[model samples]
Target chain A: MGMARAIEMAKEFGIGMVSIKHSNHFGMSAWLVQQAIDEGMMSLVFTNSSPALPVWGGRSKLMGVSPIACGAPAGDERPFILDMAPSIAARGKIDKAIRQGEKIPTDWALDSEGNMTDNPASALEGVMLPMGGPKGSALSIMMDVFSGVLSGSAYAGHVTNPYDPSKAADVGHFLVAIKPDLFMSLEDFKARMDYLYQRVVSCDKMGGVDRIYYPGEIEQIMRDERMKTGIPFTRGEIDALNEEAKLVGADTLNV
Target chain B: MGMARAIEMAKEFGIGMVSIKHSNHFGMSAWLVQQAIDEGMMSLVFTNSSPALPVWGGRSKLMGVSPIACGAPAGDERPFILDMAPSIAARGKIDKAIRQGEKIPTDWALDSEGNMTDNPASALEGVMLPMGGPKGSALSIMMDVFSGVLSGSAYAGHVTNPYDPSKAADVGHFLVAIKPDLFMSLEDFKARMDYLYQRVVSCDKMGGVDRIYYPGEIEQIMRDERMKTGIPFTRGEIDALNEEAKLVGADTLNV
Candidate 1:
C-alpha cells in the first residue's frame, strides 16, 4: 500500500502512522526503504530476529542478527541509502560462500564450540560474530530494543526463522518516516548531501587505493552495471527461488 | 558556562541553539554529553584528531582517532549514554597499557611498518586498527561526514592533535541538542527506553556470563566504585600531571 494511505489508515487506529508487527522476512532492507523513499520522505527501517551472535567474551548466542536501513531522497540522483547488518557477516553471506564452495573469512564466525571456523557450513551451525566485537554487539542489542521491545513484538531467540515454513516466527519490524519539510528545506539538504558526496569522492587516496566510495555509491553503481549485464545468481539459489515461485503458481524470472 | 546560556549565545549567531565548533578537546565525551543532558535535551557530540588508524585493507594512515557520543535523559535513572571510538582500542587505552608495563592486545595496533605489534610505544609510532575492519572504518567515515563535513569543520588528517602544544591543531567538534518535547514527550520516551532496557537485562544469560549491561551501566558502576575506592594513577602519570599543573599555576590533587 502507498505510505500515505497506510498513514491514513493508522490514524484511524489512533496511532501515529502504522507500525508493522510480526512481519515475514523482507527480502532486502534496501527494497523496503526504496518503497518509502518513493513517497518522498526519509525512511528508517529495522528488523530483529533469533540470536545468532554472542556478546563480547561470552560463548552463548544472546542477540539477534539485526539490520538497519535508512534512505533519503535526492534531487537528481538516486536516494541516499544505507543498509547494514550489525554482524561481521550475515548468515546469508555464509550461505552464499557455502554455495560457491569458498572458505569463510577468519574470525567472522565461530563453531558450535565457540572456536573460529572458516567452513561455511560450520559457521552456519555456529554464531556469527558481531561487527565490532562488544560495540557491534551493543548495536545489535539496541536494534532489538528499538525494533522488538519498543514495538511490543517478538525478540531475540524467540523469533522464528523465515526459511522454516513449518513454524511461525514472530518477526518484528520498526519503521519511521519523516516528511522532509519537518526540519529543513528538502532542496537545501539535497544540495548539501550532493556537495558532501563530491568532496568525499574527491578526497586524496591512501597508498595503492584508487577510489573513495560513499556508503551507497557502490550499490548504485552495481544496480546500473547489473541492469546492463544482468543479475548473477548461483544455480542453487535459482533452483530454490524457481521452485518456490512454481509452488505459488507464479512465473519465475529468466535470470 | 551553563549549557542553556551557551546554547542561547549560539542561537544569537544565527545558528541552532547548540552549535559547537573548534572547542578545545573536552576532557571526556561523556562529560560534555552530561552537560547537554542537564539542559533537558538529547545530545550528539563528535571530535576529530590526528591519524590513529588506517582504513580497512589499506596500510597507510588516513583518518583521525575520532569518537562520537550521544546521550538522552531517562526519568529517575541516570541518562542513557553511548560513547565510543571506532578504533579497536582508544589511544588512551594504549597509554594506560604502556604506563602499566602491559602488552597491548593483539590486533589493536600496528608497528611503524604496518605490521601488528603488541608494544605500546611501537603502536604509538604506528597506527591503531579500526574495530571489526570495514564496519568500523565505515563508522569512522560516517563520523567525519556527520561531525566535520556537516558542521563545515576540519576532517580526518586536517584535524589537529590536542596533545601537541607547539602547533594549534584547529580541532573540530560538533554538538547537537534537541528538545524531546519537539518530537515526543520526555516521559513517554523515557518510559519506553526503560522498558527496552529492562527486557534486555532480563533475558537469559549465556554460559559463563553473569549479567547483561546496558550502554552506561558499567560506567556508572565504575564511577560508584571509584568514588569509594579512589581512582588509581601511576606514579609517572601523577608526576606528569603535577608538573603540568604547576606550569599552569594550578594546584595538584592530593592523592
Candidate 2:
C-alpha cells in the first residue's frame, strides 16, 4: 500500500520518499521494486527488523540482517533488481535447514558461545555472521538509521521480534521512487539499462561455472517457473495459512 | 568542487544531485561526504573508476571496486559516515603490500589463473575479489550504473586506467546532498543521529575484542592523529609530490 502511494507521488513529483513506521514485514523486497518498475520508475527499498546479527566486533545481536534492495527498469531485457541481506546467509535459510533437519554451513553463524557452528538450531540461538565483517555490519546499521531512527520507529536493538508476542513489532521501512527520466529520456535510460544487463550476463564465466546471470535474473527465472508450475507449499504451511484466513473470516486456500 | 555546488543547490532547493562526467579520480570519497556533513547536510557520494573486480561468477574483471559512500551529521557526537569499497580489501592495500614486500591475505584477490594468491604482485595482475561475492559485485555494478552510465561517462569496463595514458580517464561521479531536516527539526535529526552513535559504540564486545567502533570512526581517529602529528610521508612519496608540484608550477615542499 505504501508502495502504491510512493509510486503515485513519484509520478506526480520527480521523486517520492515514504518513511513508514510501525509496519510489518513485507515479503520479498523485489516485489516492491517490481511495483516501481511496473510504473516505469526506479526504487530503493529499505527496512529495519528485529536484531538478528551482531555489530562488527560484538558477539550478541545488535543489528538486523536487513536487506538492502533497489531496482531500475530495462528495455526488452531483465530489469536490474538487487535485493541482498547483510548476513552471510539469510535467517530464513537457517530456519529452512532446521525444518529439513539439515546442518548449515559453519560460516553462516556462531553458536551462543561465540564458536562457529553448523547446527541449525544452535545457530538460531546465536547470531548470524555479517557477509563481509565490518562492511555488512555497517550496512545493517545504515538500514536502521534510515528506516528506524529517521522514521521514529524502534531501533538500536529495540524492535520486538515477531515471535515474541509480548509487544508490537514496530518495524519501519524507507522507500524511495524516482522517475527514470529524471535526467534523460525514458527510452535512453532503459536502453542503457538493457545494455548493462547484457554486459553483466555475458561476462566471461569462471572455471566450472555455467551461464552468468544479471543481478535479479535468477529470481525472475524462478518466478516464471513457479507461474507455470504451481508454487510448492508444505502441507503444514498450507494448514497454517488456512487457519489464519479462517480466523480472519477470509477465503481459505482453494488449492 | 562538485560538492560545493551540490551543497549550495541543496541549501536552496532542499536537495541537489550533481552528476559529473569525464573527470579523474577524486581521492577519498569520505572527504566528499564530510563536505556535506560540514554544511549540515546528508549526502551520497558515488564514483566509477577503472575495472579492478569481476562480476559474481566471471573470471575476468568487469567492474570497478568503487566505493559506496554516504553520511549524516550529529548534534554533539561523531557523525554517521560510511565509505566502503566493494572489494574485500582496497586496491591501495595491495599496492602498499607490494611496496613493503609483504604478502597480502589469500582472500584479498586471485592470481591471473583465478587461484587465490597471497603475493601482491600476482593479485595485481589478476582481479580483486568482491567482498561478499554477488552482493559486492552488484554494488560495483550499481556504482557504474549511477555514476557512469547515467552521467554519459565511460562504463562497463571501458574506463581507462590512470597509468594507461592511452586515453582520457573519463571517470564519472554521482553526488547527492539532502537536507537532513526535511522531515523534522534539525535538532531532532541530530539528536537521533547522536543516539545511534552511542548505541552502536556501546554494543557488547565479543571475546578478544576490547572496542567496537561506529562506521568511519577509525578513519576519524586517524585523521585527528594525523592533524596533531604531521602526516607521515616516505621520502619517495615526497619526491613524487614535489615533482608533480614542479610540473604544475605549484608551490614545492619546503620541508
Candidate 3:
C-alpha cells in the first residue's frame, strides 16, 4: 500500500499525500494511520472499494461502503483515532447475523425491491444503507473522488472486486500525512491531545455505565486482547495465504 | 469567518487549515463549503455546538450534534457537498414535527428516563441519538477535537447555547481548503468529477424511482429556483432580521 511510503515522505518533507491508483485491498485504515502516528505524524486516509451501498434515496448501488480514517498521537496511552465506513451497517455484520440466525434492525438495509426490511437473509440479498442517509452517501462519493477519480484510479462501477476471480479489485487510496512538529511542538501537541482525551473520558457517566471511551479506545483494547490471545485463522485461510505467497515466491505468513 | 480566510490561505499556499476558538455560531456549514468550492477550492469544515446528543450508550448529554461539511467542485453545474450533524434527527426537524403534532420515530431520541420514545415532547425534553450509534458519537468527538479542543475553545458540556440568553456561546470551527490546481489540473479534475457524477446518477434506478441525486443536488435545485423567485420569509423572521441588522447599524431589507 502507499500509506507506508506516504508516511515516509511526510516525515522527510513535512507534509506529503499519496493517491494510490492500482492496488489490492488495504487492511483497516486505522492500522495505516496509527502506523504514521507512531512515527509522530498526523494522518488522514480515504479509500474506495467495490459498490455496496446504494445512493441515498436511490435504488441502484452506486457507492462503496468507503472508509474514512484519521489519527494523531497523544502524550498518554491511546492515540486519537477514527475509522468508520459510510454505511449504517456493513454487509459483514449482516452476514454474521444471518450465520447466527438473527433478525436485523429495519434501518440496516433495503430489500431487493428497495424497501426497508428486517429479515437478515433479504438484507443480505439487498443493498446496505448509508449512515445518516444522504450525508453518508455524499461522504462516500467524496472519498471515491479523492481516492479514485483524483488519483486516476477506477471510479464508480468501474472498480472491480478482488474476491471475484475475474476482477482485479483496482482499489484506490488517498493519504495525507502531516508532521506534528510543523504546526506546533510535538510534545505540546501531544500534551494537548492527552488533555482532550482526559477531559472527554472523565466526564460524568450515565447510570449503569462504568466506562467511557474515545474513538480509538475500544479498538486499541481489542487489538491488545487479540495480540495476547493470538489471532485465530481457519485451515483454509492459512493454505490460501501460503499458496499466494508461494506464487509470489515470498516467505509465507504463518497465518 | 475562518472558512473564507482558510480558503484564501489555501489558494495562496497549497494547503491551509484554520482553527477558530471563542466564536459565535456559524450558520449551516454547507454554506461555508459551497462558498469555498465556488472559488474553485476544495474545503472541509467542522463546527462544535451546544450539547444535544449523548455519548453512544451513555445517558448524560455530553456531546454536541456537531456538524461536518465538505465540498468540491464537480464540473460546472454544482459542487459535491455533504453537510450533516451527528444526530439521528436535528432539533430543528423535531421542532417542526412537534409543531405539526406528529409522532417522532422511536429510535430518534431517548425519553427523560432513557427509554426509547415516540412522543415528540418527551424526545425534545431528552437527548437526540447519534446517527449510527458509536460511529456518529465518535465523529462528534472528532469534530469537537478539531474545532473546540485544538482551537483552545469550549468543548463538550462547556460549550454554551447561543439561544440561551444568559450564556455566551464559545463555539469553535475548523476549516481546511486545498487548491485544486495544486493537486491536478482544474479542468481535468472537474472532468473526472463530472465523469464520476454522471456514472453515479445514471445508474439504473430502483422500482418507483425516477432519479438519483448526488449530495447537494436538491440544494442546488432549490437555490436556483429560489434565485428566480425571491427567497420567502415569515413576518416574524423579517422583523427578527431587521432587528439584528439594526443592532449592527445596517439597512433594513424590504420584504
Candidate 4:
C-alpha cells in the first residue's frame, strides 16, 4: 500500500518518500524495487525487523538482519537492484537446514552459549553472525534509525518476532522513489545505466570463473528461466499450500 | 565547494543534490559529513577513485576501495556518522605497515598470484580483498554507478591513481543533503537520535568485551583527545612536511 502511494506521488513530483509503521514483514524487498523500476523510477527500500543479530561486541541479539535495498532503471538492460542483509546468512536458511536435517557452516551463527555450532537447531537458539563484523553491525543500526526511530515504530530490539504471536510485530519501513530523469533526460540517464551494466558484466574473468553477474542479474536470470519452465516445487510444499488455501476457501494449485 | 553549494541549496529548498566530476581526492569523507551536520542537515557522500579492489569473482583489480559515507545531526548528543571503505582494511594502512616494516594480516589482501600473503609490498601489488566478499564488491560498484557513471566521469577502473603522474585523477563525487526535520520537529528527530545512541552504547557486552561505540564515536573521541594533546607525528613525517613547506615558501610548523 505504501509503495503504491509512493509511486503515485513520485509520478507527480520529482521524488516521493513514505515511512510506514505498524506493518508486517514485507517479503523480498527486490520486488518493491522492481515495482519502481516498472514505473521508470529509482528507489530505496529500508525496513527494521525483530532482533536476530547482535550489535558489535555484544553477545545478545540487539539488531535485525534487515536488508538494505535500492535500485536504478536501465535501458535495454537489467536494472541495478541491490538487496543485501548485514548477516552472513539469512535466518530462514537455518530453518531450512533444520527441516532437511543438515548441518550449517560454523561461521553462520553462534550457539546460545556463544560457541560456534553447526547444528541448525542450536544455531536458531543463538544469534546470526553479522557479516564483516563491525561494518555489518553498523549497517543494521543504520536501518533501525532510518526505518524504526524515524517512523515512530518499535525499535532498539523491541520489534516482536514474526514467529512470536504474543504481540504485534510493529515493523517499520522507509521507502523512497526518485524520478530517473530528475537531473537529465530519461534517455541519457538510461544510456548511462546501460553502459555501466555493460562494463560490469564484460570485465575480464578470473580463473575457473565462466561469468560475472551484476548485483541482481542472477535473480533476473532465474526469473526468466522460471517463467518458461514453471516453478519446481516439492510435493510437500504443494500440500502445505493446498492446506492453507483450503483453510482460506481459495482455489488450490493444480498439480 | 560542492558541499557549500549543497548546503545553501538545501537550506533554501528542502533537499539538495550535487554531482561533481574531474576532481581530486577530498580526503576523509567524514569532514564532508561534518560540514552538513554543522549546518544541521543530513548528508550522503560518495566518490570513486583508482582501482585497488576487485569484483567478487575476479582476481584482478577492477574497482576502487571507495568509502560510502553518510550522517545525521543530533541534539546534545553525538551525531550519527558512518564512513566505511569496502575493503577489509584501508589501502593507506598497507602503506603505513610498509613504512613501519610490519606485516599486514593475511586476510587483508591477496598476493600477486591470488594467494593470501602477509607481506605489505606483495599485498600492494595484488588487490585489496573486499569485506564480506560479494557484498563489499557490490557496494564499490554502487559507488561507481552513482558517483562516476551518473556524474559523467571516468569509471570501471579507469580513474587514474593519485600517485600516478601519467594523467589527471579525474575523480567524481555524489553529494546529497536532506532536511532532518522534514517529517517532524528538529528537537524530536534529535531526541530520537539521542535515544538510538544511548541504546546502542548500552548494549550488553560479550565475554571479555569492553564498551561498545556508536558509529564514528571512536573518531570523535580521538579528535577530542588529539585536540588537547596534539597529534603524534614521526620525525620523518615532520621533516617531509617541512620540506614541502620550504619548497612552497610557506611557514613551517614549530618543532
Candidate 5:
C-alpha cells in the first residue's frame, strides 16, 4: 500500500498507526523493511512461530524461535538492515548442520530432560535453548505477545509448525515504520549514527577480540561476498529446491 | 507531553512517531506505556547496559545486561505490560546478595576469567552471562542497536554505570508509542488479544510444568502483592538509604 494511504487509513481509524500482524513468512525482514525505507521511512518487523526451544531454566519446548529485523535508509549505501533469529542458530542452520553430519553446539539445544546436547537429532527432539537464557526467553515471550498475542494469533507451543504443510501455522508478525524526520532531521540522524558507529568501532577490544561489529555489518559483508561468488547451497538444499521446481513444472538447475 | 502534541511535533519533522530514550531508570516500563494508553496508544521501550555475564558457549563477560518493555492499553483492566532484562538476574540483585551475605546462584554470574562463581564480588568483577547464550547476546545486540544506535545513545560496555556517578554513562533507551485505534476498533483489538491469550494458555504443558504464565502475569501479581504488603527492604539497603539521607540532612526509616 502507498505509505500515505496506509498512514491516512490509520489516522481515520483513530489509531496512532497501523502495525500489520501475523504476516506470512516474508523470507528476509530486511526485504520488507527496505520497502518501507523506499517510501522514506524506518521500519521494524518481528515474527514468532512454534516452540522450538526451551525457556531459560526450563527444559521443555515452550517458546518459538522468534526473529526480529530492522532497517533505516542511508543516502550513499544500501539501507542499514539488521535481521536475526533469537536463537544461537536458526532452525534452517540446524537443518544444514544435520545434513552435513556436524555436531550441533552444546549450548544450542537441550535433551527432552533439559540436559545440554550436541547431537543434531537430540537438539531437534529437545527445545532450542533461549539466547542469553532468561533474557532470550523473555525476548521470545515478548515477541510472542507483540506479534502473536496482540495480533490475536497462535503463540508459543500452540503456534502451528511453519514447516508442516498439513498445518495452517498461524504465525504472527509485528511491523512498524517511522518517517525519518519524526523527531530530528534525517541528515542529523544519519550523521549521529555515523558518529556512534565510529566511536564504538574505535574502542579498545577485549583479549583475543580483534574488533567489534555493529549488528548489520557482518550481514552486509556476507551479502556482498556471496553476491560476487554466487550463492552457495549444500547438496540437500539444492535437491530440495530442484524438487520444488519440478513440482511447479519449471526449469531447474541451470548450473 | 500530551500524545497528540508529541505526534504532531514528530509529524512536522517527517517522523511518523516519537520514541523517548527515558532516563532515571524508570522503575516500570508499563508506567511509561500507561501515558500512551491514557492517550489511547501502544508503546514500547528498550534499554541496554553492562555485561552481567557471558554468552552460553564460553564463560566470559561479553555483553550487557539489557531489558525491553512494552505496553498496549486495553478497555477495562490495566494495559498489557511486558518488561524484562536479558540477564538471569540484575546487577542490583547481586548487590543484594552481597548485603545479605548470601551466595549468588551458580547460573547467574561468572568470575573475572569467566568461570562460574557464586561469589558476588567475583560476579561483579566478571561479566553477567546472557540469559540463553548466543540468543541472549543476539538480543542484547538488538537492544543495543534499537535503544542505543538508533536512539543515538551509549551501548554495551560503553554505557555508563548507573550506580557509579563519576563515570559518564550514556546509557541508551528507546521508547515508541502508537494509537492502535488508528487501524481497528478498540473493542475488536481487545477481543482478539483475549482470544489469543486464552488459546495459548490452554495449551498442554510439558512434564510437571503446572500452568503457562503470560508475559506480565508474574509482574502483575508481584505489583499487587507488594502494594498490599509494603515492599520489603533488606537491612543493608536500609542502611545505604540512611547514609544517603544523612548526606541530604533528612531523617530516615519512618516507614
Candidate 6:
C-alpha cells in the first residue's frame, strides 16, 4: 500500500527518493522495484531488517543482512531486476540449513569468537559473512544508515526482532525512482538494453554451464511458469497462512 | 575537472544525478562523493573501468570490476565514506603477484576454461571472481549501465583499456547528491549518526582482533600517521609517477 503511494508520488514528481519509516516486512525488494519498472520508471529499493549479521569486525550482531534491489525496463526482453543481500549468503539460507540439520559452507559465517565455521547453529548465534568481505560489509553499513538512520527509523541494534512479540518493528525503507524518458527516449533505452542483453547472451559460456542469464531473467521464467502452474508453497507455510487467515476471520486457503 | 563541473551543476540545479561521458580517471570515488558531502549533502559515485571481470556464468571477460562509493557526514567524528570494488580482489593485486612471481589465491579468479586457478598470469588473462560471485557480477552490470550506457559512453566490450594507447580511453561516471536536511534536522541527523557509530564501536571484539573499525576509520588513522611520517610509495610506483610527470612536461618529484 505504502509502496504504491510512493510510486504515484514519484511519478507526479520529476524524481523521488522516498524513505519510509516504522514499516513492517515489505516482502522481496525486487517486487517493489518492479513497480517502478512497470510504470516506465527506473527504481532502486532498499530495506533494513533485524540484526542478523554483525558489523564488519565486531563480534556482536549489529547489522541486518541488508539488501539492495535495482531494476529497469528493457525492450522486448524481461526487465532487469538485480536484488542482493550484502552477506556472502543470506542468513535465511543458514537458518534453513540448520532447520534441515545440514552443514553450511565454511565461508558463509563466523562463530562467536569470530573464527570461520560451518556449524549452522553456531553461525546463526554469531555473524554471517559479508559479500566480497569488507566491501560488502561497507555497503551494508551505508544501506542501514540510508534506510534507517536517515529515515528516522530504528537502526542498528535497536531494530525490532520479528520473533520478539513485545516490541514493535521499526523497519526502514529507502527508495529512488527516476523517469526513464528524462535521460533518453524510452524506445532508444530499450533498444540499447536489448543490444546489451544480446551481447551478453551471445558470449561463450563456462564449461558445464547451461547458459548465461541476467539477474531477473530466471525470475521472469519462474513467474511465467508459476502463473500457469501456481506457486508451490510448502505444506507448513500453507498451514501457517491458514492459521493467520483464521485469526483474521478471513477465508482460508484450501491448500 | 569533470567531477568538479558535475558537482557545481548538481548544486545549481537543486538536485542532480549527473553522469559524465568520455571522461578519464577521476581518482578515488570517495573524493568525488566528498565534494557533495562538503556541501551538506549525501552522495553516491560510480564509475566503469576497463574489463577485468566476467559476467556471472559466462567465461569470456566482459565486465569491469566496477566500484561504488557512498558517503555521508557524521557529527564530530570523521565522515562516513564507504567505497568498495565489487570483486574479491582488484586486478592490481593479481598483477602485483605476477610481477613478484607469487602464486595467486585460487578463489580470486578463474582460468580461461573457467576453472579456478592459483596462477596469476592465466587469471589475469581470464576473469577475476566477483566479490560475492553472482551478486557482484550483477552490480558491475548495473554500474556499467548507469555510468556508461546512460551517459552515452562506451560500455561492456566497447570500453578501451588505459594501456591501449592507440584507442582513446573513454571512462564514464555517475554521481548522485541529496540534501540531508530534506527528512530531518541536520543536528538531529548528526546526533543519530553519532549514536549509530557509538553503538557499532561498542561491540565486543572477536578473539585476536584489535578492534572493529568503520569503513573510513582506519583510513583516517592512516592519514593522520602519514601526515607526519610521509607516504612510502613502492619504487616501481615512484618511477612510474616520475615518468608520467616527465611525459607531461611537469616538474619531477624530488624523491
Q: What is the interface RMSD of each candidate, in Å?
A: 5.9, 1.8, 2.6, 2.2, 5.7, 1.7
Model 3 vs. true fold: TM: 0.86
Return the TM-score for each candidate structure: 0.70, 0.88, 0.86, 0.88, 0.73, 0.89
Candidate 5, CAPRI quality class derived from DockQ: incorrect
Write candidate 1's Cα lDDT for B1-255 as tens digits.
434654453234211223244555666788876876676655556666566567655566666657767666666655667787888877899999989999986677777776778899988987788886666765666565445544445664566667878766665565545444332466775665665566556654543558777766799889999999999999999999999999999999776
The numbered model that scores best in DockQ is 6
Native contacts recovered by candidate 3, as a share?
0.41
Better of 3 and 6 by lDDT: 3
Taking the tens digit of each residue's C-alpha lDDT, what string does model 6 give over A1-255?
555665665566545677789987688998888888888777778888888777766667778887888887888877778888888886689889989999987767888778778899998777877776667777778888888988889987778887788978898998888666655688987777777787777666765678889878888899999999998899999999999999999999895
TM-score of 5: 0.73
How many residue pairs collide in each prediction? 2, 0, 0, 0, 33, 0
Full-model lDDT, candidate 6: 0.78
* Cα lDDT of model 6 by residue, B25-119, tens digit: 67788787777677767777889888877787777778877788878788876777887777888778999998999998676888888878899
lDDT of model 2 at position A120: 96
On a 0 to 100 scale, what is the lDDT of residue A218 in model 2? 95
Stretch of 10 with least lDDT, candidate 6 chain B: B6-15
Model 2 stretches with alpha carbons more than 4 Å out: A91-107, A115-124, A238-255, B91-108, B115-124, B239-255
> Candidate 6: which docking quality band?
medium
CAPRI rating of model 1? incorrect
Q: Sorted on DockQ, highest at the top, how do the candidates line up?
A: 6, 2, 4, 3, 5, 1
Q: What is the lDDT of residue A105 in candidate 5?
A: 65
Tens digits of per-residue lDDT, candidate 5, B1-255, equal 434554454333312343444343445556666666666566676776754444444455445667667766655444556676666667899999999999986667767765678899888987676655444555666566566655555654566666878765666666665545444577866665565445445544544557756557667779899999989999899999999999999998864
- Of 5 and 6, the candidate ahead on DockQ is 6
DockQ, in order, for the candidates?
Answer: 0.18, 0.57, 0.48, 0.50, 0.22, 0.65
Specify the highest-lDDT model's number.
2
